[model samples]
Target: MDVWDLNLRHLLAVARIVEFGTVSAAATAVNLSQPAVTQALSRLEGQIGMPLFDRRHDGMVPTVAALLLAPRIDAAMARMSSPYVTMSRLRALLALADVGSYAGASHVTGLSVPSIHRAVADLGTAMRRKLVERRGRAVALTEAGVQVVNAFRLAKVELETGLSEVAALNGQETRSIAVGAMPLSRARILPRAVTHFIRRYPMVKLGIAEGARPELVEPLRHGALDMMIGALRDPLLEEDLVQIPLFDDVPAVIARAGHPLAGTAPDRRELARYGWVVPPRGTPLRESFERHFAEVGIEMPKVPIESGSVMTLREILIDSDFLTLLSPDQVSVELEAGWLIQLGALPPELGRTIGLTCRASWRPTEVQRAFIEELAEASAGLPGALHPDLSPLLG
Candidate 1:
C-alpha cells in the first residue's frame, strides 16, 4: 500500500499488542475491546501482506517484521497526533482573527498580543497569501486563510508540543556546564566547588573533565568547556581566552619529616646538594625554577627522579629522601599530618599563578554568572590567595 493508505490507528493497535503481551491487555491499554484490537492488528497485517504477531502459548509475540516496523509506526503516530495537540491554540488564533480581537488571541494562546500578531503575520507569509484582511477595526480570513487554518489544525498540537519540549530542554535547569582543570585541581579544588554549586542549584547538570594546559586550551577555544581552573601557562593563553589570575601557588621543597632538610631553612647552595624530584625540564615549573636559580647565581639542581604525577611524588616524598617542589595545596594534608615538611623558604619568583580561564567572548548565562560570583566569594578568604587585578584592564 502507498504511505497515505497506512492506517495510524491499526499501527497503534499493533504496537500496543506487542507492548502489553496479550490482546486483552492491549485492548485495555487503548480503551478498545479485545476483538476490536485483534481485528485492527489483523487488518494491519493484511494491509502490509505479513503476519505482525504470532499467537504463542505464552503471549502475543511480535514477528521480526513487526519489530522492525514498530519504531516507524510509533513515529508516524506521533506525527499524526501533533496537530491535535495544538488544536486549541490554532482554534483560538482563528477565533481572535475572526473577531478582530488581538487581546482575545493573546489570552487564548497564552502569548503576548504582539506575539500573536507576529505569528499570524508569519503564517500568512509562509502561505504566500494573506490569511487575514483588515477593514477599519474589523479583521476576517480570506479564502486562502480558511485553507491554511484547516491545514494548520491537523498538526498544530504536535508543533506546539515539540516546541514546548525544546524550550523546556533549553532552560537553565536543563543546561550543562563544562569544567576543565588539571588532575590536581579536579581532585582538590573542583570537588568542593562543585558540591557548593550543586547544593545551591541541584538541577544544573555538570560535565567535568580534567587535562593539562596543552590538552585543555583547544577544548576551551572550541567552546567545549565553559571554564577552566589550573596553572596559567603562557602558551595556553591565546587571543580568544580570558585569563583571570586567581591565586599564586609557590613550589616548596617537600620531603619526609626525618629527611635532612626538613627542619632547616636551606639556602640555595644547600638545596642543590640533594637529589631532586622535579617535573620534566621543558615544563613551566622547571623553566621557572631554572630562571629563578640563575638570577640568584645558583646552578640548576640535578633531578634524579622526574615525574608528572603529584600523588606519586607525594608517596616518594613521604617514604624517601627525594626532594620535590610541589604546590602547597597538593601537600597540605601530608604537611598537616607531619608526614612531610617544608624544607626552606620558596623564593618569591618561583611562584606560579593559578587562574580561572574562559573564552574571551564567553558571555556567562545567568546560572553560570551567578556560580562564578559565588566562586569569587568562596575563593576570597583562602590564605595566600590574591584578588584578581582588573585596574590595568579597566583603565
Candidate 2:
C-alpha cells in the first residue's frame, strides 16, 4: 500500500500507543481523547490489513506488525522535525519540488494543478516560510524549501522501509534498494553482485543508477539512493557518510590494441607524450593519473577530453592516440575483446581504494543487508584483491 494513503496523525497515535502500552496514555501524549486514539488505532489497523494491538485487560499488547512499524514511525517523525506538517502538505510539496512545475507535478501525482498549488501554499503558511519560488518557466525551492524537502525525503524513506519490513515479515517482498554506481562498479563487481542477489532473492527489486560521484552523492545524502560503489576518497570529509574499502583497484594505462605502445612498457613520460582523455580532475582515477606523472618528475599530460563515461573513453581510445588511466575492472570486457589494451600499469601506490559508500545512519533491512554482503563477496572475487574476503565488518 502507498504510505500516502495512511494518515500522519494516526500513525503517530499508533506509535505512541506502542510506547505507552495503553490507548489512554497514548491519547494523553498526543492530546487526543482516549476514544479518539482507540478509533484511530482501529482505522489504522484496518488500513494496514493487520492487527496493530491486541486489546487486553492489562494494557494494549502490540502485535508483531506494530513492533516493526513503531521505530520506523518514530525515526520518520523525528526527521520531519515538525508536528504541524500533514501528510497532504508533505506529499504535495515533494511532488512539486521534484517535478519543478505545476503541470509536471500534476502529471506525476494525478492531482489537479490547483490542488498542488493550494497544498504548497498551505505548507508554506504552516511553516511560516516561502517554500517555493518561480524560476523563469519552472519552480525552484528556496533554502527553506530545500531543507523541508530533504527532511521529508528522509522521512519518506524511513516510513517506506518500515512498511516494507512489516510486509517482509508476512512473506511479501515489496521493498527495493537503489544503488548509485560509478563507472568502475558497473563493469564487473556490481553486475556480479546484482546477478547473485537476484538469484537468491528474486522477488526483491533493485534499481541501479549510473553516474559520477559528484552526481550521485547528493541523492545518497537525501535518501534517494541506498548506497554507492566506486573509488574511495581519503579522509572522506562528510560526517554523515561512511565508506567501506572492499578492494584496491589497480590503475591501468590503457590505449587501443594496435597503438605504438600496445606491447611495450612505457615510462610515465612516454605515455604522457600522447594527448589524454581522462575523467575530470576531482575523480579518483583522474587524481591517480595526475600523481603517476607529477610524482615521478614528469609533466602531466593535457586532458583535452574529460568525461566519466567508459563508452566515450573506449571509442576515443579505439580510434585515436588518446590514452587514459582506468581500473582494469572498468574496461575488462574491452580488454578481453581486444578493442583496447593496457600499455602499462601504474605504480601500486597510485591504485585506488574502491568500495562502498552509504549514509552512516542507514539501518538496512534483511534484503538490503544481504545485498551489501553480496557486494563484499563480489569484491573479494575480483582479480588481485588484497583480501580473500572482505565481509568481516558484516560478520
lDDT of 2 by residue, 70-169 (tens): 9999999998887777888888899998889999998988889999999999878878989999999999999999999998999999999999988877
What's the lDDT for candidate 2? 0.87
- What residue runs in model 1 are displaced by over 4 Å at the alpha carbon? 1-172, 183-189, 234-237, 389-395
lDDT of 1 by residue, 96-181 (tens): 65457777777755668787777677655654677787777767778877655544432332222222222333352344577887
Question: How do all models score by TM-score?
Answer: 0.53, 0.93
Clashes of 1: 8
